[model samples]
Target: NYLWINHGWMGKKVKYKEEKFKITAIDGGWSKWSPWSICGKDCTHTKTRTCDEPAPSYGGRHCSGKDTIVTNCTGGLCEN
Candidate 1:
């Protein structure tokens, strides 16, 4: 028996006897960061937040970068 499959609008016909396929899930992504923790007594402290995205699945692209980030705390008393 023969089977014909249309490749696309191009009207190309393809013949196949049998085909194999594999599927995989993507990597997981970082979840939303918790509230910023209290900064140190010093004004020169750091604050951070995180992403809350789900991880990728089924051989999908994995989350590449960091989940959390930190920034200088310039509004604290220490700054004075």
Candidate 2:
């Protein structure tokens, strides 16, 4: 029950009686990745890394594993 509207003197109507909020659940954030992209044909390469964070609202708790991760690069043997 909440209704508040007052504009100068042309509209005045206020009646509110609702106060009970207990929402808590948000645990998901990540932002630390962006330095592994430049290996797509050297000798068996494959690198990747990315993370922009921001993912968890109103009862959120996810994003704890991987945003983008790939490994396996040598670039030192390929020419036969």
Best by lDDT: 2
State the lDDT at 74 in candidate 2: 56
Report the C-alpha lDDT of model 1 over 23-47, residue by residue, as the tens digit: 7565666665566655545644443
TM-score of each: 0.39, 0.32
In candidate 2, how many Å is residue 23 off?
1.9
Model 2's lDDT to the true fold? 0.62
**Which residue pairs show backbone clashes in model 2?**
none
- Model 2 C-alpha lDDT per residue in residues 11-63, reported as the tens digit of each score: 76766777989987776677766676655555444433332256677777776
In angstroms, the error of model 2 at 26 is: 2.9
Model 2: per-residue Cα lDDT at residue 14: 69
Write down the lDDT of every candidate, Cα atoms only. Answer: 0.60, 0.62
